[model samples]
Target: MRQRTGRLLGPLLVLLLVGAGPDGSGETVSLDGDRPGERLDVTLTRVVDPAGRADSERLVAVELRLENTGSVPYEDSPAPAAHLLDTAGQRFTGTAAATGAGPSLPDTVTLAPGDSASGFVTFRVPAGAGLAAVQFALDAGLGDDVGHWSLS
Candidate 1:
């Protein structure tokens, strides 16, 4: 009986995951100026699933494009401090990398005016947590200069 249940669960899980649809749709977000002369353009390209099995947590990688449109250069990185927001209002913190899988952002990115950078921000969320959007704080933990991308 136990063996039979296990066989059935595998297919059922696959079907459920398939029906969840592709990575969160791309969205554009404008970042605020942490200082008087800082502006940025952010685009959430897509949200991808982990290539390997997610036995513990569902680690999703968010692809993004960051452009500095301000006069001063962006002297900080956007990957290590990114966060994810789900439909249920739960927030998932971002990770530098997904253990051993997924892409990564640069360590020290300095985007000058008109310069742009593209990379991934990984987040570890609970399995099947309906992700609604991604939030980025330009100043890391400063809670200033924020940009939000709606996945829905």
Candidate 2:
């Protein structure tokens, strides 16, 4: 009975550790897409309302850190494909207008093994919209891998 219980706890412990964020705040996701061996780690570093309006719309800035954990190079533009989802199921794409509101992510990114990049992606949502999560992807969402960070 002790051995059986140990086996059950072993896998459960690994699962919890693997899913846990380093700082206990953001999430880390692998961006393999069609590549079998590619492993890119994306972490949501911060998210904030930068205090301003864009034609009756409020701006939300999402800060992210991307690290190349695989053995190969990962190159793509993540800013254009980043999105904001509201509680009402409304999806808001990253906006260029909000770029001036914060330090925006580069239009192109090339990450070699062990390389990392950090920047912000901004979105314009309705004035009173309740943001639920932020969705981010490479290749303008054409890739299979997508990372989501919950706001609440």
Q: Write the per-residue lDDT of candidate 1 for residues 26-53, one digit (tens) a residue.
A: 5455565557677777776767866334
Cα TM-score per model? 0.72, 0.75
Model 1 alpha-carbon miss at residue 64, Å: 0.9
What lDDT is reached at residue 143 by model 1? 40
Model 2 spans with C-alpha error above 4 angstroms: 1-25, 96-102
lDDT of 2 by residue, 59-143 (tens): 8888788898988788777777778889899998874344544567787788889999988887888899987777766656555
Error of 1 at 148 (Å): 2.0
Q: Which regions of candidate 1 are displaced past 4 Å?
A: 1-24, 51-55, 98-102, 141-143
> How many pairs of residues collide in model 1?
0
